[model samples]
Target: MKREIVLLAMFTMAIIFMAGCKQHGTPKPRGYYRIAFPEHDYKPFNKKSPYTFDLPVYTEVGDGAQPQTREKYWYNINYPNLNGILHISYKAVDNNLNEMLEDSRKLAYKHSVKADAIAERLFISADKNVYGTLFDIKGDAASPVQFYLTDSVRNFVRGSLYFNSVPNKDSLAPVIDFVKTDIVHLMETFEWKEMPKL
Candidate 1:
């Protein structure tokens, strides 16, 4: 009789264990995204002549998505390593250098609806004084954007995209830090020849 009872208890315990295991199935491990940058590679500046620089291998350039707009030059660069797309744009705001500078400044750091925008300063280079500002929007609507620009005569600029899934700005600190130096390198390497009159 004791042997029979022991066998029954063991079966009951096994069943309970199996049920519990199913009830709390082990979770698939979360993905860990490490920061991996590609070896430097690049092509000559497409729009401007007399400038050359290297960008990461994985980066790609494409025609700007918006064409009907008034912007002069617009290009899209996909940075897969960063899981985002960056937009490089140029537009003649007012044809005045000072006005352009002011507009860029406003785009960098003004956010009120009535105002232009808001950007967080990330890095600045000494030689070209290239500065970076992160433009962050809020909500499920859209995380925000990142844009770095220079008032240099040729109107050079660069930008990057983030996954938007996790955008603490703190979490993005690593890539932002890495790319800022790259941006400065690009700015310093920048050279623009006067466009020949048509």
Candidate 2:
């Protein structure tokens, strides 16, 4: 009887081991929170700013927060849901167009230490007489996008995009791609609202 009991216990242990072997546990793959993107719709930024562009419906235009931005026609395009801001600084192109252009280049390149790559795309709209360069910065940079628009005579506007959260290229990839499209739309529709006097 004792021998039968031992045999029964061994059989039960064998069944349990076989059952456990049939199913394997795996660690869940790392993941990020699912993002709900807004529909793409834009309205004209018809405010009294020196320039005008079509702004995405999701954004709000407000005065810039930097001290240097004060009284400089600087503005911030705030994304409430995305927790991002696009800083726009407008400067009249007196005789400092060269300086402004160089400054913009410098600002965009400042992220080179953290960025894997920096791409410059030339923008030209001969009919509107608006020309500029858009800087697309990739990797873990603080600012992922920077651009400058100029009539090459009267107006120069520089813009940089920054997220309110920590910079994580992998996690922010989707949001970055989405916002990049909006920035391109803004640039494509950009125009000088006021003509310079001769």
Candidate 3:
């Protein structure tokens, strides 16, 4: 009788355990946290510089934070909440327009090893005298976007976007898209300040 009782209990426990775990376990895929992006808005950049543009309200402009002495008119448009920055460098055309254009191309193409592809788009505004190329770099490379704006006569400027964190294209796609719009806006509103007559 005792043996039968023990056998019955063992059977009952086995049945309960089997019923509790009826389904097979499956692994869950990894996911990234959702980011709440802010509304896109712009205000005219109010700094003393050779050129002017409408910058996103979410940014603050400051001198470049480099170890070496920074050049005049070189500034950084900082994205405080996003941990990103747009480095802006200005140069007088000085009859070296070809050299400057080549340099910009080299700078953008340097990331091509890590980048999947790079798209070059021409930007021209005869009214504003802003003519240059905008490079949209794709992949897990640094400086996903870079551009050079120049009147092709007197003023030339270059801008590059970078983030403080590691470059993860999958995770950063949304933020990158968000910031790309602002860069386009800056380009759209770019205008060179009138030079004083010598």
- Candidate 2, clashing residue pairs? none
Instruction: Provide the TM-score for each candidate, comma-separated.
Output: 0.54, 0.88, 0.87
Candidate with maximal TM-score: 2
Candidate 3 lDDT, 63-121, residue by residue in tens:
87365865668889999999999999988778999999999999999999999999999
* Superposition TM-score, candidate 1 onto the true structure: 0.54
Candidate 2 positional error at 34, Å: 1.2
Report lDDT per candidate.
0.53, 0.91, 0.91
lDDT of 1 by residue, 35-148 (tens): 776555555556542223455556776776465674545666666667666666654323565665566556544434432334355555546444444454332212245555
Clashing pairs in 1: 110-117, 111-117, 137-144
Against the hidden true structure, what lDDT does model 1 obtain? 0.53
Model 2, residue 190: C-alpha shift (Å): 0.4
Stretches of candidate 1 above 4 Å error?
A: 1-32, 41-43, 47-53, 92-95, 111-166, 196-198
User: For candidate 3, what is the TM-score?
Assistant: 0.87
Segments in model 2 whose C-alpha atoms lie over 4 Å from true places:
11-25, 65-69, 195-198
